[model samples]
Target: MLKGRIIKALSGFYYVEHEGKLYETRARGKFRKTHETPLVGDIVSFQIENETGGYINEIHARKNSLMRPPVANIDQLLVTMSMKSPEFNYYLLDRFLAYGEAHDMEPVIVVTKTDLGNDVGKLEEIKNVYEGVYPIHFTDRNNINENLNDIFKDKLNVLSGQSGVGKSTLLNTLVPGLELHTAEISNALNRGKHTTRHVELVEVGGGFIADTPGFSTIEFSEIDKYNIKYCFPDFNAYSDDCKFRECSHINEPKCGVKSAVESGQLAKSRYDSYLAIHQEIDNRKERY
Candidate 1:
């Protein structure tokens, strides 16, 4: 049996790369009995029955998994946003961060379209809110390569952001000949059309990137409330000091988090974002 990693899966066929060669393979019948579907980034054992195709025999364990893209073993999530055209939404960024934290993955924020008269002061405000906790990159033609090369090195990064934020354009610039589709933001609604319909892993700069479908919004109901605080890195220092061991950090008397917010130790905007997410989780609990 030959070993390979799956690069794409579509219509019951898996495209795997083995020893610089690509092969189209189908999973063995046992995988169906086991309810195992070969996903992108999965390492598998296969048998080449012919020159161009093979049969996937076994799949190794996964390090991580994402539902939307249905990929496995992601090392980092590159959350891309724009400075103006479509307007950057911090709430969306927070939701993505929460998702990353829930999955035990690292999240990095990338601000694009720096060449389009982006407000430096506004960008600074965002940086101030998240700088210490996550790595942030501002990219345009002048420094796009320099900035991205540093973060994407030796990691399986996913390029995710709202539509029309130039995600596909950025990928093309980084890895020429990628040939991914690019779409213009709707002039009427100022939103981007979905160009990537399916998830596929592409090799770039000695690393892999999973290009995912564009989304206007993300749901956080899948995450648990008890683990929400962990996603907000800035809240960590004061969370342990709450008077009650099970403090939710909202309306709890003598809560260290509240005190820190009152003392200006944390950005009010960040705190508000936390409260919003906490309330969302609380509301979801009522349903169950």
Candidate 2:
């Protein structure tokens, strides 16, 4: 058997990449019986039937995967958002960051439509909050490709963000001739319609990127109160100094996370997001 990674899934074919060559293959009948769908990022063992065809015999375990885009073994997430139209939001970005961390994928922030909004103060504020914690990039129509190669180099990156936030536009900019469809925000609904319909891993700049259909919101189905704290990268060092060993930082006295929030050591927005997500998790658990 030969080892290769599935780079794309179209119709019923799995385009596997091995040794700089793409082989067109398909899964066996047993995979369907087991209800196992081969995702774009799956590494599989296959047998080459001839010069151009084969069958996937086995699938390797994945490090992490996202449900919305349905990509697997992702190294990082390029969280793209717009500065206008849908409007720049810190809370939404926080959610993306925390969720990516929870799934063991690094998150990089990309702010799009910079020239449209002309909000310098807002941009600076976004940068200042996440300056040391995460890498952030800004782009406009004229120069959307700047500094993008370093962010996505040699990683399986999932490109995602809310609708009308320019996820497709930025992707097309990074990979010219992609020609991904873009939509304007609906004045009546105040959101953009989904432009991307399915997820397919496209290779560029020595990396694999899957552009997902833009979504308006995401829920924390997997996260719980106890584990959400680890999702915030900024709280790692200070969490040990808390009065309690397993501090949630909501009402716990002398909690290091809370102290940082009070002393301005941590961004108030981030702490608030943590609190909100924690509450949401608790609320969700209570409902079920």
Candidate 3:
């Protein structure tokens, strides 16, 4: 048996890369009986039937998985946003960050379209707020190759951002010869159409990058509230100091998180996101 990683999955076939060679393979029958569908990024053991094709015998364990893109064992999520054009939505950015945090994946913020006049001072403000917690990269074509090459070196990363934020353009820039489609933002709607229809794990620059469809909505139902605070790296120090033993950091008078917010130690925006997600979890409880 040879070991390899599933680079792509389509139409009941998995394209695996083993020893620098790609092989078309199918999963074992046991996976079908167990209802276990192998996903992109899965490492598996397989037997070569022909020089070009094989049969996947066993699927190894996964480190993490996301339903939207359906990829597993993601090392980092490169969350992209624009400075102008469609504009940056802090709420949406926070949601993506929360999703990464919940899955134990590193979140890196990549701000695109820096050439578009950097209006409204939003880019600077975002960098100031998030730089302390996560790495941030700024890019336009002039410096995109340097920025992305430095960031994605020897790591498995995923590119996720608002539709018009130049994700596909960046991908094309990073990996030349890629034919990923790029679209213009609608003048009337101020949004770009979804161009990437499927999830694909592409080998690039001696590492792997998954190009996923732009997401309009992200759900956190798979995450539990008890562990949510851990996702916000900035909240770590204060969260441990909460007066109550079981402080949820909401409606608790002596909550350390709240105190930090009042004292301007923690960004009000981040705290607001926490409260918003907490409320959603609370509503879910009521429904249950």
Tell me the alpha-carbon RMSD of every candidate: 3.4, 3.0, 3.4
- The residue ranges of model 1 lying beyond 4 angstroms of the native Cα positions read 141-145, 184-198, 213-216
Q: Name model 3 segments beyond 4 Å from true.
A: 119-121, 184-199
Q: Tens-digit lDDT track for model 1 on 166-231?
A: 777788778778766675533223233232235678777678888553343566766777878878
How are the candidates ranked when ordered by TM-score, highest leading? Answer: 2, 3, 1
**Which lDDT tens digits does candidate 2 get at residues 1-288?**
889899877777888999999999999889988888777799999999998789998889999876556678999877877888778877888888887888888989888888885777998888888999998888876786567877778899987677677777777777777876665533124233222234677777888888554344678887788999899989987888899998888888989988888888889999999888888889999998
Cα displacement (Å) at residue 239, model 3: 1.6
Q: Residue 158 lDDT in model 2?
A: 83
Q: So what's the TM-score on candidate 3?
A: 0.89
Error of 3 at 258 (Å): 1.3
- Angstrom error of the Cα, residue 278, model 2: value is 0.9
User: Lowest lDDT 10-mer window, candidate 3?
Assistant: 187-196
- lDDT values, one for every candidate: 0.78, 0.80, 0.78
Query: What TM-scores do the predictions have?
Result: 0.86, 0.91, 0.89
Instruction: Compare candidates 1 and 2 on TM-score and give the better one.
Output: 2
